[model samples]
Target: MSVEAIVNDVKTRADVVVTRGQEALEVGVKTLKTANGIVVEGVQELVQTNVSAGKELSTLVQASVTKAKTDGLKAVASNPVAYLPEGKATVLGAYSESLKIVSKTGDELAKTLKSGVETISAKIQGQAPVVAKARKTATKTVAKAKKATKKAASA
Candidate 1:
């Protein structure tokens, strides 16, 4: 089979694994939320901690990608089908590159989620008073906008 086909198969398998992990995490979070009053607060703290730890996870994954690349190349090379005719080497090379690409994609996703969480946490911390104030402000703004639109429609 082609390297692209092999990579697609690997990706499909990885996606299933990731989905299961997310589901397990969700269950844990839900269990914690229901178990104790303190768990709710603790879960929020956990989210903050996880966000901060994202960078570390990204770094670890990057290292893992190096290992995966080597292993993936080896697997491709060892496969009799991958060592077929003319473009076997090229296909194997592409397969190795695909592993790196998938790893990098995962790293990027972690970094993005970490950055977003950090930003949201910082904003929540920095604007505790302002958030409440903004809520009222938003309410009034929406009311006024609705009134104006209604009046324009009538006119």
Candidate 2:
């Protein structure tokens, strides 16, 4: 084959390689987006689970306290001498304390979830610009390399 024909063939192969590289880059970008979506979904599910667990715990506490109150009231009525007025149990106070504890725990979980989401979003945002800059730099470098190759082949 002639020199010009071989040079043209090599250039064609190089162009094909560059095109494939760009395609791979695009695929990577898509994968990144998919990964981000998955992460967000996972975090949301975790937050929901946390909320559900808090609610279940609160329900259990309320049920147990209600039963205890019923039993105590019976005891006080049956034995007035043993259950003095000064030593009388306050059901409302117990329930109020339980509610406060549950509320505090739920609030903490919510705050943690919010903090985690903000961190993940910030990191994802931070990586995008760097990836974009790298891709731009790579395209420029590839173009320069192709130009140099063509010049050398022609000479």
Which candidate should be chosen as best, given lDDT against the real structure?
2
RMSD of 1: 29.3
- Tens-digit per-residue lDDT, 1-155, candidate 2: 99999999999988866765565555455434443443443344344445545666666667656655777977757865553332113444445545654554454334433434443443444332224433344344334534644554455
Q: Which segments of model 2 are wrong by more than 4 Å?
A: 2-4, 69-155
- In model 1, the runs with Cα more than 4 Å from the true position are 1-84, 127-155
The lDDT for every candidate, in the order shown, is 0.46, 0.49
Backbone clashes (count) for model 2: 0
Error of 2 at 150 (Å): 55
lDDT tens digits by residue: candidate 1, 37-92: 22233333334334434545566556655655666877756764533234444445
RMSD of each: 29.3, 20.7
Cα error, residue 25 of model 1, in Å, equals 24
